[model samples]
Target: MARVLYDLYGRDEQLRFSPYCWRVRMALAHKGLDVEVKPWRFQQKDAIAFANTDKVPVLCDGDQVVADSFAIMRYLDDAYPETPAVLGSGVSYQRALLFCHFVDRQISPALFRIVALDLLAAIHPDDRDYFRATREARFGCTLEEFHSPEQGQALLYKALAPVREVLRTSPFLDGETPSGADYLLFGSVMWANIVSRQAPVIEEPLVGDWFKRLCAAHNGLGDQALTVRDLGDEQSA
Candidate 1:
């Protein structure tokens, strides 16, 4: 079976930085699976039409085609039962799913607003118009008008309050060990980290430390991402 994952990329094809795709990437790593990660862009819906979805993070595992991050993770667990469970069983999976929902509903919005313009700047040239149009239509304002660093930061911190409390006491979301919940949160924070000049998660020491640890997991997988902050650090170095 040819294991392939269509991951979203930015202006630089090497910069595969989609939150949903990151979730899948870490899930694959957690399961000790090897895959060919293909760089996909916002305007490349036709490329994934075979999967019946216009989104990246589409996993093609031989005969199986799975779309959506959560579904893909479920597929991973089911298809490779011998591997470590990505979503655990019933109750545990529900808990992880809740975290996924919280990140999508609360954290992702703030992160998006925080990096709205920066994200625009980083998108592939062919995707710029599509990104700007869809985003502006959703928010009813231009990216320039929607960009709210202060408010986004405030909202992000507020949404992360419970998460901070958890991290203060436990090393990971699943307590001692990172779980599906960890990947979901990490993916969202990574979206901001890679696209924005600043990583808001760094302001919260406990959560930031947890994030750092997870980045170093699966062989420094997340840490290897080409973050905006990394570029600045490189230039300064």
Candidate 2:
């Protein structure tokens, strides 16, 4: 039996809106691979001893330990070549890889601000006041200075332009079917909507249409909570 652990609750000291974990989950779903999902509590790294890399979203299949979302996704693709996780390795693949790198360097960091803001509100209400005071002195303004609505809009544009353009031309980012790029962008956009309540990127008609389509596809998964035992029990010996 194999188990996949994801940080479902970004509630406590966890990194919310994890792009990496989202990629792995989507890959599993797309490939029709059943994985046991273990949702971890914040500050429970010791419990994930098999994670070796000390990270969330590790997939343990028998004795094999899979870490790093991209690596895991690639491994799945190779292991299940019949379904093929990645699309063609032509221009589409190149573009997808380019966007993946851009997302890691550009969008992911900016999006972290949204998570940090949410954490401040949840974990340290008192520190919020102190942070504002000190942050102003240090950064020339408060947290709002760097994370203004105007800046958020710009961040959304820069982060989503590649995806929006792709969606405008094609049904999916890579091709007719969703690929790694779709998962990456979906996770980022979903995070924005959940934490910041803003998805300026998806407001565009083309991108918005694509989002609706994916939502429709995933509507059947429901909000069911899965445990390790369930996955292990169902796994073949």
Candidate 3:
């Protein structure tokens, strides 16, 4: 049986936008695993109850069910030792872990502000109330206030300063080749690209170049992903 990856999608199922899910998607591809992506929405918590987690990026490999993106990545690496390493060396794996945390805790929150309204508009109708309630509580403001494009863009640039400096010298965060750390950061940017009408621009020329390289990876898989506007006729054109 092909592995089942439960990925979060918007109203249009093809527009898969969850950053965490993207990380796992790239990781699976990195390992050359065949996966069937099942589009999941926020309101469909019961659909993934078997995994005992309300969140997405759930991996069901036969009898084994893994929730959480990081856990699923580790599961893939451990279960399929013959495949290419997802985390790479011990030192590299440690660095990847830190980068993942940084992306989640630092980068994602900033990016969320810019895309919050667009994300709200794109989610399934059934999930609207749930998403709004949860996100409003987390940010302690209305969605509109939270989704201040200008402020969000400034925060995003500030948060990405370290990444810009690193890319100034190295091709990838892990040195020569793209590593788990690179995927972690790329996934965050993919979040902005998929949900927002205005994609956040990386100020550093090298950083922009690195993003283009990532978009061209896996035979242009990233570039081919459906953006929010792609769901509409105008953006599709």
Instruction: Name the candidate that leads on TM-score.
Output: 1
Taking all chains together, each candidate's TM-score versus the true structure is: 0.94, 0.72, 0.93
Q: Candidate 3's residue-wise lDDT over 125-153, tens digit each?
A: 67889999998998889998988777877
Better candidate by lDDT, 1 or 3: 1
Model 2 C-alpha lDDT per residue in residues 50-149, reported as the tens digit of each score: 5676566778767777787766766776677788555335675566677778877777656555444543343223335654675467557556555555
Task: List the candidate numbers ranked by lDDT, top first.
Answer: 1, 3, 2
Off by over 4 Å in 2: 12-16, 87-95, 113-116, 119-146, 197-201, 218-237
Query: Mind giving the per-residue lDDT tens digits that candidate 1 earns over 126-208?
Result: 88999989989998999999999888889988999999888878999878878788999888888878887756545778888
lDDT of 1 at 108: 95
When summed lDDT is taken over every stretch of 10 residues in candidate 2, the lowest stretch is 225-234
lDDT of the structure predicted as candidate 2: 0.59
Any idea how many clashes model 2 has? 0
- Report the alpha-carbon TM-score of model 1 versus the true structure: 0.94
Model 3 TM-score on a 0 to 1 scale: 0.93
Clashing pairs in 3: none
Residue-level error in angstroms, candidate 2, position 105: 1.6
